[model samples]
Target: MKYRIVEQTRPGGMLAQVYREVLVPAFPPEELESEESLAETLETGLGSLLVAVDDTGRPAAAAFGHWWEASRVQMLANLAVKPGTRGHGLGGRLLRDAVDAWRERYDPCLIVAEIESPDARMVHEDYGDPRRRLGFYESAGARVLDLPYFQPGIGGASRRVQGMLLLVIHADPTFTPERLDRLSGKLLRAFITEYLAAAEGEPANDWDAKALFRAFDREGGIPMGRWGTRP
Candidate 1:
C-alpha cells in the first residue's frame, strides 16, 4: 500500500477524528487533551504533528512531538493507528517520518517516547496487559530509562497505578557530551512531571540524567538502535 505524510490539518482530517473517537476512548478524558484542544495546541507552533494516509488516501496512523527547549530535545507525545489498520507497520512508518522530519531541522535530535509499563495497574485494569505495546517499541530500539511513574490529570487529580517507560533514540552521530547532558536533562524532567510525579504513593519526586542513564544501562532486552538491530 502507498503512504504519504500530511500535516495535522486538512478538511475533515482523519487524524483529528481518530484522536477524538478512537485513542481517547481507551484512556481517561482527564489524562489527555481533547482532539479540538490538541489541534489548537499543534497549531501554536510549539510542536509538529503528522498523519499518514494509505494508498487510498485514508488516514491510517498519526504521531506528534513537542520541542523541549530547556533540554534541546523532542518529546514524542502521541502515536496511534486506526483500530483495524494496526499490525501492518503503519505506526512504524509514521514514526520514521516524524524522526526524519525532525532531523532535517535539528542535528542529533534526541527523541523521547513514553509507554505504559507492563505491570502498571492502569494497564491491567483499563487496557489489559501492555506487553504488545511495550514489545512494539522495544523492537524499534527504544530502551526503558526509568520505572513507571504517575501521569497527572486535570486539577491536580492524578491517575493511580499508572507508570511510564521512557525511551530515547539519539539521531545525531556527532552527539557531544554537552548535547547528551541537555538531552538527558530534558528526559529526566519529562520523566518526573509526566510519569514520576503523577504516580500514587510515595514515589520519588526528583531524578537526574545520571539516574535515568543508569536505569537503562542496566537493562539490555531491546536492541539499542536502528530497525535491523532487532530480530
Candidate 2:
C-alpha cells in the first residue's frame, strides 16, 4: 500500500495515463476537465496535479485542483482513486496530502470542494454513488456550505450542472464549527465570482454564474451543513 506522490502533466506522462485510466472513467464529462484543459492548467501554473503511485509504480489515485488568489481559496476540482483500489483509505490519504501540499504552496485560507449532491439525479452509473463520495469527504473533515450551488459548464456543448454541494475545510488548526457556524459572505462571493469568471470567461455574462453569485452576495454569511443534507 506504499505510495509516493508525483506531479504530472498532459504531455504523455503518467498524468496522461491517469487521465485515461482513472479520471475519464470516474467522472461524468460535465464534471471532468478535458485532458488538454488540465494540461494547460498545469502548464500555466494555475493548477496542481498530484498522482499517488503504488509500489509497483502504477498510479493508484490522482488529485487536481486550483488556487484562487483573489479569495485565497484552494479548489479541489477532482480526487479519484482507481476503481479496484478503493476501501483501503488511499483516497483519503491522497486528499489530505494534496491539501497539505497546496497549503504549503499557496497558503490558502479555505479549502473548497465541488461535489455532486447526493439527492440529485445520477449523471451516470460510472459516476459512482454521491452519498459514498460525500461520506468520504466528510470523514476527511469537509463540511458542506449551505448555498444554492451549480457548476458552470466547461464551455463548448456542455451544460451547467446544478444541485452541486459546496464543501469547505478550514485552514486554521484551532477552527471549530462551534465557534462559527457560517463563513463570511463577502469571501464566499469573491470565491464564487472568481470561479465563475474562470469557468465561464465572464461571470456576469453567464446566467448560472450570476445567480450563484447572488446566492452568496445576498447572504451576510453562509451557514455550514452536514454532508448528506440538501442545500
Candidate 3:
C-alpha cells in the first residue's frame, strides 16, 4: 500500500471519502472531530494527515497525529481503517508506518496514544472492547501506561472523554522517570487545550491543572505497563 499525505494542503481527492465514509462512521460523535475542526487542525502546522492507499489507489486507511515540539513527540490522534478493509492488519501497518515516518522526520523520543482503559467499565458503539484495542497496540510494541490520563472536552462540546489509557512507545533508552513525567504533561497540554479544544478566552491545558485534576483525577504517576490486563 502506498502512503500519501492527505491534508487541507492538497484537497479535492480521496480525503473527503476517508473522512465522511470511513472515519465518521467509524468513530462516535464525541470522538470524531467535525470536518471544520479537522481542516482547521491541519492548517495549524502542528499536526499531520496520513492515508494508506490500496493497489487500486483507493484510500484504505487513514490516521492523524499532532506534534508536540517541546518533547519532540507525536500523539497518534485518530486511526481508522475502511470498514471493508478491517482485520487485514492494515491498522497495524498504518500505525507502524506512521511511527517510522514520525521518527524519520522528527526523531521523537516517544509516540503517544490515548485509548479506552482495559477494564470492562466504559464502552462505545462499533469498537467498544477496550482490551481488543489495547492488544493491537501492544502487538506493535506499544505499552499501556498505568497513568490515569483524561482527555479534555472536545471544542465547545460538554461531553467528557473518560476511561482513557495512555499508551506510549519510546525511542529514548536514556529516559528517566522524571523525563517521562515531564513529557506526559507537555503532550497532554498540547493535545488537549491547544489542538483539540482551544475555545475563546480559555486558558491552555497548562494553566488548567486544578480543573484537570478535578475533572480527570489522574494524579498517580505509575509508569508500569499493565500486561496483566491483556487477554
Candidate 4:
C-alpha cells in the first residue's frame, strides 16, 4: 500500500478526525480524551503536523512535532495509527519521514520524544508487537534519554508519567566542545522546564540527570531496536 505524510489542514483533514475518533479511542481511559482538545493545544508557530495515508487514500497514522529552537530540538507529539493498519510498519515510515522533514527544514537538530512509563514497559515486553514503536526509532539512530518525569495536562490537571528519548541524528559532530556544551545545556533546560516542568504537580522531579545519563550511556545506548536484543 502507498504511504505519504501530509499536513493536517489538507483537503482530507478528515484523516485527522479518523485518528482522533478511532485510533485514540483504543487507548486506555486515561488517554482517551487527550487528543480531543489538541486542536488548540497544538496551535503553535513552529510545530509541524503530519498525517499518513494508505493506498486507498485512507488515513493510516499521524504524528506532530513542536520545535524548541533554543535547544535546537523538536519534540515529537501525538503519534497514533489505526489499529488494523499498525503491524505493517507504517509507523516507522511515518516517523522516518518526519525526521527527514525536520532535517530538510532544520538540519543539525535533535529529535526528542517523551512516552509514558507503561508504554515503555509494554514496548519492552511485546514480541514483534507493532507497538514496539521505540525500536524503529532506535534503528533510525535515535538515543534514549531516560528522564523519568510526568507530563501534565491543561490547567495542571493530572500528570502522565513519561520518559524522554533523544535522537541526535543530524547533529554536527564537528562542533567545538564549548558549543556542544551550550547546546546540551539549553536542551536539558528545555526538557526540564517545558516537558518535566509541565508534570510537576503529579510527582516530584526526583530523577537526577546525572543518574539517568549513566543509566542510558552505553556502546549502543539502551538498544533502540527490537526487544529481544541485548541492552
Question: Which prediction has the highest lDDT against the true structure?
Answer: 2
Which structure is stronger by lDDT: 1 or 4?
1
Best by TM-score: 2
Q: What stretches of model 2 exceed 4 Å from their correct place? A: 8-12, 123-125, 156-158, 171-179, 205-210, 218-220, 228-231
TM-score of each: 0.66, 0.88, 0.75, 0.65
> What are the runs in model 3 whose C-alpha is more than 4 Å off?
1-12, 120-125, 177-201, 204-222, 227-231
Residue 161, model 4, lDDT: 32
Runs off by more than 4 Å, candidate 1: 9-15, 26-31, 121-129, 152-161, 171-187, 190-231
Please list the Cα RMSD from the true structure of every candidate, rounded to 1 decimal place.
6.5, 2.9, 4.6, 5.9
What TM-score would candidate 2 get against the native?
0.88
Please list the C-alpha lDDT of all candidates, in the order they appear: 0.56, 0.78, 0.63, 0.52
Candidates sorted by lDDT, descending order? 2, 3, 1, 4
**Candidate 4 lDDT tens digits, 1-231:** 787778652323454575555446444444323443344435545656687867877777777666666556676755677766766887777888887887777764466665443245443221223335566655766554433334444345343433534434334443213433222433454444554443344422444534544443333223332224323
Q: Give one digit per residue, the lDDT tens place, for model 2 in 54-91.
A: 89988888899887878888889999988778878888
Candidate 2, residue 148: the lDDT equals 75
lDDT of 3 by residue, 1-231 (tens): 554434333433565777886678777677766766667656676666678777677777888777766556577878888766677788887887778777777777667787777764544545545677777888887766554455556664345466676677654544334543323443444444453445323554443345553433334333445557522
* Residue pair clashes in candidate 3: none
Taking the tens digit of each residue's C-alpha lDDT, what string does model 1 give over 98-172?
888876765434677766666555432333246777777767766554333344433343343245565675534
Model 2 / residue 115 / CA error / Å: 0.6
The residue pairs that clash in candidate 2, if any, are none
Local error of candidate 4 at residue 156 (angstroms): 2.1
| Residue 197 error, candidate 2, Å | 1.5
- Candidate 2 vs candidate 4: the TM-score winner is 2
